[model samples]
Target: MAQQVQSAIPARSGGNHPKGLPYLFLTEMWERFGYYLMLGIFVLYMKETQGEGGMGFPAVTAYDIFGTFIAFTYLTPFLGGFLADRKLGYINSVYLGGALMGLGYMGLALPGLGFFYASIALIIIGNGFFKPSISTLLGNLYSEEQYKDKKDAGYNIFYMGINIGAFVCNIIGAFMRNKFDWSAAFLSAGVGMFLGLIVFTIGLKHYRHANVLKPAVAGDTGIGQVLSLVFLPAIIAGVLGWMIPGDILGSDSTDAFIAATIPVIIFFVSLYYRANKDDKRPIAALLAIFAVSVMFWAVFKQNGTVLTDWAQNYTDRQVSESMEQAAGKLYLAEEVSSKESMVTQYDNQFRTLKDDNGKEVKAMGRSVYFRNIDPARIPADGKPVYLVNTELFQSVNPGWVVMLTPLVVAFFAFLRRKKKEPSTPAKIAWGMLISALSTLVMVAAVYAGHNGEFKVSALWLVGCYGVITIGELFLSPMGLSLVSKLSPPRLTALMMGGFFLSTSIGNKLSGILAKTWYNYEDKSHFFLVNCGLLLVSAAIGFVMLKWLNKIMQEKGVK
Candidate 1:
């Protein structure tokens, strides 16, 4: 990979992007389509009753599994990047990874707990091999002089491709699952991955030249060294954590993740101490940023669980019969009627609809909104209504991303033009602070809805996502750029891996917080915890700003 970075690589003759861009774009679009599709429905599947064809795991169990899956998914990219750098070329790694993910998605559609667990493992391993290689291959494209100046712009376009896929996948999921069954929804994800593989193969002629495997080089940490120093100790620690009697930190999985991180953290710190004199300050600065960034990621990643809970159970989702009829014609919404069997068995919420004569009747489903609707707002009894699909809420964040990206870019450009833009570190600090503010939006919703005994408006969730989207634009993209700018030349990939490690930890912590949903008596307290974490992170960033800025200036990068 380093050789590919420094070698004289060929470039497209014209000013246009290489022929690979469109192929990679479409390929990644489809890949994300598959990923987010399963993710959109995953928890819903886990928590559903067996009669509904779901796994029916307990809420905390489901959330813990979700967090572990998400954490391990991020964790493997380092290994994937390592394998690509050493042995498997980019093209082959992508092929292997895509194939595994496709199979995993298919496996998820099948019955049996064993298949489900094994499938999750396959997808996690596949993502490790697939994710970093493609990104690295894409980065190699801009290494050519022709594309150098437009590197950022190229990535912006690529980033939009990801959001486009993410935003659309949930609608696809809602339609497939609501119309047919869980099997159909999972199968759709598999098909999307397969389509991505096909597109990648079609574009092989363009990027194939850039996919060469890099041989072992001086000062590189060998696989044996990594195992002995990091992997071995981590595995032992994790086993110990899992084996300990009783729950040490909420759950066994959480305990294992925290324990496993100990050795990994030590390894990262050792990198700082072992760095050459000139590299130490930059490494320290990036490490500081990584530490602060964890809180942001932990809170931000709850979109799939905590936020999904709100969308599924706490918001007004019922639609007019006319609209429902129209949407149902296209299989676009979940259909719930006033039928007696539609109510979740043995758990009918206390509620009654009133007629013109003032007699009481029932119109209800498993949707929490209906379970707790104010009687005054209930339509005349025995009316059928359709609820907006729960999976559609998954699209909200990515939808915001699509809408907000250009605005954020223009805002920052405007600042840069006036020489008033915040430095990268400052932007991240403010991003955390802004994220804290977004939690207050949910707090307001909780109060407005009277602790969820009343169905709140969907606008509150949308509003929270809008604010967080701005913060995401500030922090996420900049964190990637920061890693590229500050890392020591030989250690660049390692630093990138380090950045992802922080994200993996944050992702797990999100799950830990989410698992506490049942523990909180008032739903408002759930969101408040998210607020507090972000506030603490922002405070840390503010305190470190002066020293971090000095390091950035010395390192001569933003």
Candidate 2:
């Protein structure tokens, strides 16, 4: 591999940064466009009735699959980073990963059970390579002193592009899924991913300088040793977990997931143990941040799972008739029959109550949960309400991101000018606190709706997304910046992988939490629990502020 590939070569420079940055920016935008486009509809497709061109899985089951896929998708960056650091280099890794992911998205369009699972596996493996390599490449671009000070701003700009793709994808996904078929939407995602690959290929020359292969550090584990110690054992253990006679985690798939995570966890733990003295404190700090951040992700990711269920089944989605003609012409909205009797299906899906023997006893009249909604609030009979599709709700957070990025950037820029800015850790701490408050909107919605007895205004969802997007603007990009700033030069890419590893674990936890969605008797309590979890995480982040700021000062970042 080394002989086949050359070291990273520098790209041409312009005013303040490399000319390649724009190309890289566009590439990431399209890549996220594809990924989020598919993800926005993944769970909805799984849980929708078969008549609607979906798999019609149970809600909890769909949440589990959603969580697992997202978890493993983040996990692979570790392997990708390790290989890129040692052998393959960043550019090749990105190409290989993008191709696999594109193929995976295409495979999902195939109408066969065999292709379905296989497609998920391909996406998981492919994401491992693609995710970390690109971030590492971006970090390399800013390594020069001239660009170093602007690194956070550049990442914020890049992050905005990511959200732009995310914001627009839901409209495309909704249009494709509603107007054509689920398969068409899936295929569109594949096409978008492939387009990103094409853009990356065209821009390759601009980023070649950042793809250098580093010599292994002293005491660095050999490739052969890592394979034996990590990959081989992990596979064996996972298979064993799957094949074991007794159920350990309710399903073989769950057992396998838990088992598979073991070796990966061990490897990260070993990173701390093996660190040099200078690197130890920083590594410890990163690990601490990673662990605390999981709760935030667990709650935040529910936008696609439990929250999606609420939007589809409980929220008022009736469109106004005055705009129906134009909406229909543009193929931007869906028209479900409001007069259609949804009682039987809704009860069947939600499972309202239990009998004396603990068997499910389904109820009548739209599960009583939606019984209090005024008929006037629903669409007029036989007239199609050209309402925005449910999947479009996924765009809310990203939409807020696009609207708020400039303000957030300006806010921090103001702080920088006055030298009154909080450290990145402090920003992250405030983010969690603010994010926790966002859940209160949902809690209030629960009260307003009388525990789902009535339909809450869709504006509640909009308000919640707006509040949390501010917190996300504060935290998510800063986490990436923190990883880059605090990491040792050789460990930069590896620490990037570490950040994803944290995300992977948090995704799995999100799944676990969502699976229990049906068990919440009063849903307000559930959201409150979510709020409390974020508050605890925020508390932890604040408690460590002094130490984290000291480290930032030592590293000259704050």
Candidate 3:
């Protein structure tokens, strides 16, 4: 590994930064394009009626699968990062991961439950390999003395790439799905993944130097030990959780996922105890950050679940003639008839109506979206109304990121110049607080909608996403930058895995929280619960801010 590191050519400057930055930025963008495109419609595809060319699962089942899928997708990065550090080099791991993900996305185009599960499995495994290594590689590039100071900015820029993909993919997904079908949208994701790989390959020469393998130190746990102690136990635990007589945590899959994470969590904890003195405090600090940030993801990840539901059924999607005409031309408008016909019906809670004989009950007249809409707003005489596709709302958060990144970068740059910038930990604490406020926006939206009696404006969703995007800008990229700065060299990728581990838990929690969406009649109460969680997380972050800042100072990085 040392020889490998020495033999590679040193990084060349690309203007003010490493030449590798643009390549990495674009690679991550297309990768996210694939991932988010699939995610944007995942639950929608699952819950749509079979007659409508969808899987036709009930809302509860779809939410469960959505949560589990995202949870596991993040969970596997733990193992992927470990493998890259010990055996496969970073570049090889990325290629392997990308190929698997591409196959998985394409596979989703096939019909059948078997294909769905198999494709999801491939994506989960691929993300495990792909996610952490790429971020770790970027960190290594900045490890060069000349580039160290710009690490945070580089991550911010890279994060924008991710959002750019995320922002655009949904639009593409909307066009594909509207123009063709769900399968076409999914196939597009696969194509996007391959395009990402192509971009990565083109820039390989620029980042190859940074992909050198890190040799394990005396204290490091070997792959064999991790497989036996962590991976095997997690499998057994998950199986036990699944086979248990009843659902312990909303559903069998959620219970299983939560159980499986116990061993991995214990493993990360043990790292703090086993680390050399120099590494101990940094690891401890990171663990604390990971714990608090879980709350943020739990709420933020709702965009695909409950948030999507809000957009699809609760938000006012009606557009003016010119706007409708413009969107329709791009195939971004969904046309639904207002005529009385046999259509799927649901209670106020949005659960599917069922007959006593275990059959779904259909209501005559008006589509589901019309139930909460004002009578005057409904198109009369059975006319078809064109509305924005629900999935396009998924682009809002990432769209905010793209628009806001430059301003945020400039703001922080000004602070840096004035020598008044908050430490990374302080920035995170503020982020948590800011994120808490976004939930309040949704709470207001619920009130404005009169508890689903009428549709609310789409701006509520936009406002919520806009506020949270700021919080995300503060926390998400900073968390990545902090991990890069604070981690022990040999453990860089592993620590990156730890970061994703936090995200996995949070994603699962988001699912769990979404599961409770029907339980709240007030709707505002649901957003309040979300608000409470983030506030508690923010409080804890602020409480530990000083201690975390100390660790950063001791480590000699900003």
Candidate 4:
């Protein structure tokens, strides 16, 4: 492979930034639009009865699948980044990955179990190729003399675009599903991905300079060697775990995933051992961050599962006429306007109704929140009311992210001016602590709700998201920037993949933790688990702060 596929980026005097930012920004926006749109409704779709064109899986089964799917989606980035660095140039990889993802989303519109599974596989594989490479390429733009100082800001802006896509997609997802069907909602996701591809292609020339492919050096491990050591062993381990008679972990799939991951973990450890003296400390620092971050992601990533459940059944969603009217304009309202009180049936929701002979019928109601509404606030027998769509709750974090990105960027900039800006390590430590604090808000909400006997105000969720968003602002962009600033040029994309790997682990754990929501009689305990996770992570982060910062300084990375 050539060392660098450098294109002459168009020069703009005093601009000091690449023209490609807008293109990348918009491309990522649409990509996230598709991804988040699909994710926002994924669990809901899984829970629907088979007669309703869903899997009709049990809650445990659904979460297990969810965990596996998300885990595999991120796992491929390591391999994808490796290939992009060694063989396929970044541009080719991006196009191929985007097309695969688009096709995967569209495939969901088709019927049958095979197609569904195949579509998911396509998406997971495609994401591996798409995610890390693009971020690595974006970081490449900052390698320019004039743009280096602006890298963090650029990443923050890029992150904001991601949230913009996430925020808007839930609106679209909620409207599309409510207006049409699951097929229509999924088709919309496919269309969004294709649009992202078009945007990426349109800006090909601008990103071309950043598509450098690094060739293997004399001492580097070859693809064949890596496959033999990592993939081969992992596959055998997973199969053995799956075939085992009893549960070694939660389930067969979880057992297999855990087994499969062991070799990969070993591979990372080996990387540290093999890395030269110059690269070892930085790699070690990143690995530490990666490990601690698993806790944060485990808690933060529950938005789709546990948090969705809270919004759907526990929270007060009833909105006033004016609020409903405005939200409807944004495609954010669910029509709970029917006056009839005939109860419906669904899994994971509850209502007590009388059967013909005075026997209790454990029915599921349309507005299950009705069960938790204050007796006085409950609509008289058949009165109509409005509620925001449950999926709209998924947008709260991303919305907060978009709103606060600028302020966060400016805050760090302010600190920089005063020569008091916290180092990246310090920022990450604080991020974890703040993340721990966010869970307390949910604990308060649980108490206020009387353990789902009454509805808690939406403000609790908003507040939690606000606090977590601050944590996200501190750690996420900084983590991305740190990888770029410190990684060996040849291994930059690989390290980016590493960060995603950590997040992947956390995401899977999030699913696992969410799986236990049904088991928690005291809802506050659920939030407490999340709080404890972040607290432990924060403690570890604080303990290593001095060491991590020293490494950054030694490596000449801020």
Candidate 5:
């Protein structure tokens, strides 16, 4: 298989060009389309009732499931990268992973609960292979001299393509869900993934050269050894944790998950110790950055969790008849009749209840807003207000991603010309600090709303996303650039896995925070906690900056 892959490799063109790039880009874009499409509806699907063809889970449960799924998806890149580097070769793994993920997406559209969970498991494992492999391929392409200077720009462009898919998929999800059923929306994700597979196949001639299998390094364990040590122990530990624990992770599933990850995490840490002296420092830096960046992910990923709830129920979504007609025509606004709107404030005035079955619940009323608002603020007509869909708020980050990428690139370019640009680490610190400020915007919005007395304007939501997007522009891309710049050549994919692991942990934290939404009486404190977390993370990054910069310079990265 390795020989066949090697023989099929396109000859490298002169001047640092690898035979891949375009194929990888399109494959990534379509892969992101499927992933983001599923994400766009995941929360909504969870919150939906069984009568509506959903699992009918509570919001907290849904958040946990959502977080766990994304967490594991990022967590798997370690295995994927290893397999690509040692045994399977990049192309075969990509094909295998993409096929699994596409089928998983299709399976999700099937009608059984067992199928749903199984499909999610498949997708999660599949992503581990597909995600890091493509990224490593890009790095390998740039290893040639002609492309080395352009690697950062290439990654930025690739990142933009990712956001482009992310930006568009929500719209597709919205239309599909509104026009048909949730199943249709999920099915669309599968179709989009398959399309990505087809695009990758078409572009194979371009990237086949980059798919050459790398020889294993000295002292590298065999694939059998790795699987025995990592996968087998992980499975055993996970089963034991799930079976013997009483809420070790607050739930059996969570316990199993945390246990399942221990082996993988330990393996990566061991790599640092096992690396040759020349490789250790860079790996150490990568690990440090990974640790600090988890906090950013924890805070940033709230767009689909706590923040989604805020947009759904707290933001002022009311649109006038004329404006509604126009917005609806543009597919930007969703119209709900008075009876259908879920906008509600769970204030002291609202009496909680349960039937004999112990299913604690609240009474259905016009808008939940009436429960918390002063009498004067309640609408006299009792008519339901037309509001924008909560999912649209998910677009804000990507929207900012698209709008600000060029501007950010230009800003860095300007600084580059002067040689005054912040190091990538510095930019990430700045991103953390600026992101903290964005949370304060929400703090102000909460105060302005008088502690849930009235809903705030959607403009507030826009302002927050806009501010955070700037921080994201600084941090997210820079993180990727840092990984590309600092990782040892042999361990690039594993380090990329490290980067995603940070994201995975943060995503889980985001869910954990969102799970506490029901416990907070003063909502401003919730956002303030997020602000404090980011601020502390930023501080830590800043304190480490000089040392980190010294390493980057020693390593000869800009």
Candidate 6:
């Protein structure tokens, strides 16, 4: 394998970085394009009226499925990373994962619950394989002596690729869904995935050297032991969790996921105890970071659920008259009728109103978006109102990433030159603190909008995303870089899986939190809860900072 890898290596191109960077960058960009495009509309599609070609699920149901879907997507990467490390090599795993995801996206275009579920399953499994492999491959590319020092910068650039795809896909999704239908938008995501595969195929030669597989070391656990001790028990526990109770943690999926993760969590903790002396502290440190980071993801991942609902229903999306025509042409606006029609009646909490007989009450009403607007601001009766598309708000965080990444990079570079730069663990701690503050922005938004009695300015969402994006910049890419730096060679990708396991738990928690969206009479309290969770996470991160820093120093990594 070593000889094959060395023989396959191409001479370095006349550039500061390896020739593979652009290819990997573009590949990840398009993969995220497909993934985020589907995600941007996932819950919206579920909550839309069946007459409008959606699933017509209740808002809570939509939130549940959204949470589960995202949770599983991250969860599978653990298995995928493990498989890539042990059986399928990195490049092959990427191809397999990308292909499965593309098919899954395309399958979503078909009309049926079966197809919907099957497609989602494919995406979940596919992402498991693709996500860790590509990231590990990129890290491997930088493992070369000539490129070792640039690893952090490389991940930042790769992360920017993810945001670029994420930033643009929502615009394309909005345009497609508006111009045609949900099927068209989903098909567009599939097309984007295929395009990414093409880019990956074109650059295979450049990264072939980095695709070498690592053999298990003496202390490493065997695949059979992992399957029996971890995966099989997880499956049994999940099944029992699903069957045993009535919403132990608010929903069946949440209960099952939490239950299932127990064995996996145990397995990770055991790795520290079982690791060789040389590997013990690094493993322990990574595990600690992973545990704290779950809170960040739990809060951050709500952009697809709770935050999307806020954008759709609470944010003032009204376009100015001058821009209305342009917005419509660009498919950036959705026109809602002011005319009232017979529909299910709901209270301010968006819970369905019921009669004494337990049947839903019906009444003539405008769309939900109009429920809280000042009567004076509403258009004359029977006229159409043009508002910005809700999915477009999904682009805001990524937009901030695109706009702020360079400034962030420079800011850190300046700090580095002054010998005042924070360590990776310190940066992650600061990230949690900054992220905690962002929830306060939403708390203020709730007050500004009078608890959703009136629409708030769109700038509020932008500001919230702006603040959180800074925190994301500090933590997300740094986490990846840290894993690469600290992981034992044979275990790198598996440890990457560990990072995503934290994300998976957090993603599920996001859904669980979002499910309570309707229960909050004072929406500010909801955001305050989120703020508190992050604050606790930040406090923990800071408390552990000295120990984590010492571990990193012992490992000879920054």
Best by lDDT: 3
lDDT of 5 by residue, 98-176 (tens): 8889888878788888999999998988998988887877777776666675566566656766786788888888777
* Candidate 1 Cα errors over 4 Å, as ranges: 1-22, 144-153, 205-218, 341-369, 376-381, 418-420
Clashing pairs in 4: 7-209
Misplaced by over 4 Å in model 4 are 1-15, 323-331, 337-367, 375-378, 381-384
- Total clashes in model 3, counting residue pairs 3 or more apart in sequence or in different chains: 2
| lDDT values for all models | 0.78, 0.79, 0.91, 0.82, 0.77, 0.88
Highest TM-score among the candidates is held by which one? 3
Per-model TM-score, in order, reads 0.88, 0.91, 0.97, 0.92, 0.90, 0.95
Question: What range of 10 consecutive residues in model 2 has the weakest lDDT sum?
Answer: 4-13
Judged by TM-score relative to the true structure, which candidate is superior, 1 or 2?
Answer: 2
Residue-pair clash count for candidate 4: 1
For candidate 3, write residues 231-332 as lDDT tens digits. 999999999999998997889998899999999999999999999999999999999999999999999999999999999989999888768778778899
Error of 3 at 54 (Å): 0.9
What TM-score, to 2 decimals, does candidate 1 have? 0.88
Model 4 Cα lDDT, one tens digit per residue, 446-529: 899788878788888889889999999888888888888888888888888888888888888988898888788898898998
Write the number of the candidate with greater TM-score, choosing between 1 and 4. Answer: 4
TM-score, candidate number 4: 0.92
Q: Using TM-score, rank the candidates from best to worst.
A: 3, 6, 4, 2, 5, 1
lDDT winner between candidates 4 and 5: 4
Error of 1 at 62 (Å): 1.2
Residue 82 alpha-carbon offset, candidate 2, angstroms: 0.9
What is the Cα-based lDDT of residue 234 in candidate 6? 90
